[model samples]
Target chain A: MIENKTNKPQRDGFWEKLSKLNRRYIYMSVGICVIVPLLIRMRLPIFITPPTKSLYNVVDKIPPEDPENMLIISFDYDPSVMPELQPMGVALLKHCFAKKIRVACMSLTVMGIGLAEMATEKAKEEFPDVKYGEDYLIFAWVPGWSIVILKMGENIKETFMADYAGKSLDEFPIVDKIHNYEQVPALVCLTGSSTYLSWITYANTRYNETICTGITGVIAPEIYPWLQSGQISGMLGGIKGAAEYEILLKKNKLSKVEGTASVAMDPQSITHLLIMLFIVLANISYFVIRRKK
Target chain B: MSTNIWVWIAALLTLSVYSFLYKDNPIYRFAEYLFIGTSVGYSIGFLYWNAFIPRIVRPVQAGDYIVLIPTFIGLLFFARFTRKWTWLVRYPIAISLGIGAGISIPLTIQAGIFRQLQATMVGDFTISNIIMVVGVICTLFYFFFSLEQKGVVGGVAKTGIWYIMIAFGAIFGYTVMARIALFVSRVQFLLHDWLGIIK
Candidate 1:
């Protein structure tokens, strides 16, 4: 019922109706929007920007024989963010492993352990010879990120005693000879949350200004200053950033190399366009209905 | 035959999982449950192999009594299950928190607060960098500590808001493009790989 005193349309059933929608309608549409394009194999043109270039350069510029030049892969995302972050994880891992660089994988997020495994698997597929303890080591998921940062900085061994493979860090030649934050060359923070800031405070702060970079989803807004100030050497934020990284890796040719980042792009595009169209239509309808009334 | 059978099984599982988007059907529910079970099982296995085995069992077997401390502390996390013993969980949590907090303080002081301030203060005078520096100063002062100003400070603060808005706007725009790219990638996968509709 429209209130005659006010000119505004009745707001009844607006959100409640949307809330009551049969979830399938939304899910199916989203699924088709995602799946159909995958079946069709669409490769969208990507514009490489400074952020991605900076990320690329960071990886590219790693001194070839600097064994102390280690890259810390911090997984700070969970399955809820799997659709967005997993591809970035896989691609980043593949790049590091292919370059034959030593890596230290750790997770702050509880769910990050599985995601980190998925990344290791992707890298392992290419470099089957890369042993778990020797080539790359995963630190156990540290519960409170801030404290973990402190422990890692103060004494690496006191914070972590062993790798993920049930072997002592002391046993692994690559890891045993390390002490603290100063030994690591670069840190790649892959997250869907703000745990990156903790690293920024705890790890990157103590080191040289240019050693940290990050891969984050799109919702993050506050890190732009860090980017501009050269506090973070590079950043790959969101799926487009991942796509640009893939282009850098030249994975466009491989059939399955087109990972979830590619697959999820379809629904994302259609949904945004759909939302825009609906906004325009609703505005038009509002004007029309108002003018008539 | 074995390889082909595995391929068929995988395809069936994928289809069943994908069916959830259609509706809350049995196939989708089954797949969802399966995924949950598998994930939990995998996690339990990982915890044992990754944490318990190496940190506890092997160390003890190797005759290292020192390993018993962390091993005992980690098991303390399970105290959450017991009503009386639940308070014990705080010990490990405290230790973890202590180390994590200790690391983050000095780091944040340097990276989040100090380095950011320094970077904003000193830089080359390119057009983009200048605008950025201006934005940084105005935004910083926008949260000013000193005297109240109705006119110029307010204007600068207002301009500061605009600068932040514009910078955030660009970030948001880039985010949208990235999301769209992800959606596109998914569609391409379904078309080319699953159905073999495109080459």
Candidate 2:
């Protein structure tokens, strides 16, 4: 027992142990927190936020009969961010397909091509009636995203002369009337990077096109100023945002398939709580250890 | 619990990657290398088939001499390999930088500066709007180094610190959520997609 400045006997090594806790213990705790909730499913209520609702409303308003019902979805993320952004992409595709709204899907990054394909495949499994080249078109990735965006603003056909499969864009009736951003009602960018700013800069600022975004949560706060400035029409932030969109889809009877985002929400909530608890515990341990020293 | 070959392969790769959390080992290193190598190979293949062929090779083969000009300029990027011809790389570099700057400056100003200022100034006088406007001014004041930060400027800058701290806290929270979301996704894949333990 050691005496401190206040003449109080020093406590035992609990605080010291906690302060120097093995990282493997924390990892195991996180793993259990994530897996348990996922195994024993719980239906946690998902409240829809305004930004997500705004995005849904924008997509909902596009008339199916309107010749300009085309929506350009840019998948600007890779597998590293696929966990957060893929659900958002799949939900958006499902919404568009259910509403009979045409889609022109493209990836700014080559790595995003696989993710885009995965999302589209997942959505297509639900909408078996939806035919490719007529209902939707997937454009292949090109180098220089900023220039590609600007070129698409001028003429989409010239920018993407062919689809992802090397078929000419002219062969697709979905893009027959969509010459550029003018014919598309809105361009929804799903990104894990700052490429959305390029859309805001080149597409919205240069051509005055409507731009919305579904971004990873890490970058969502940075986009608030753009949303406030009316540069971005609406936004979906992270997996939570994807879950909200899924709720909207089910409520509108647009999708009957269970959404992966909604399914993962319970685990996400539990893991968040566990992390918060760990942070508080660490702080307390740090303070206690400092006092003891 | 799963018989699918692809699922089995994915599960093994995922476990290999997760093994790093316990201790770094050869399995984790192999998985890491595999990921990097595969990503690079995929990108090369995608660019060659989609971009190089469509934009350059096919066009050059079809009697389109105009495409050769840009191709030749792009080829100049390889000049850096030779010391004497390295000066030629500067032409393409300068052309790219010039074009990029020319295209981005006005658009960046319009999207980032003017519109933001307009929104901050002209919005309705709601509580949130007022807070935004005041926060913006205080933050700008915090960065203003012309005068001594002593009087009201100091007070405003102090408030700016609070705003910046709050913003950082929110971003930190979102970052945690993003990371947790990734973990949850992997868990879901293992439980549902691979093991069929969850529906």
lDDT of each: 0.68, 0.89
Which candidate leads in DockQ?
A: 2
User: Per-residue lDDT tens digits of candidate 1, residues B24-73?
Assistant: 69988887888899778877876667556665687799999998887788
Q: Per-residue lDDT for A1-293 in model 2, tens only?
A: 54678988866577677777889999999999888887788888999998898899988888784556688889998999888899999999999999998887898988877787788899999998898888877987778889999999888988888888888888887877778888888999999999999999999999999999999989999989989888999999988989999999999899998899999899889888888898898899888777767
Model 1, stretches more than 4 Å misplaced?
A1-36, A110-113, A124-161, A169-183, A209-211, A251-275, A282-293, B1-45, B56-103, B133-199
DockQ values per model = 0.35, 0.84
TM-scores, each model vs. reference: 0.72, 0.97
Cα error, candidate 2, residue B99 (Å): 0.6
Give the C-alpha interface root-mean-square deviation per candidate.
4.4, 0.9
Give residue A170's lDDT in candidate 2 (0 to 100).
81
**Candidate 1 lDDT, tens digit per residue, A1-293?**
34344776665444334434576665566556555655554565567868877877777666543556666788888765565667777777767776776777888776787678888887678668777766677876644467677677777766877665435577777776667776676778888777777777666665452444455456545666778777677877777677677777765332235555544554566666665664565676566556545
| Clash count in backbone of candidate 2 | 0
In model 2, where do residues sit more than 4 Å from their true spots?
Answer: A1-11
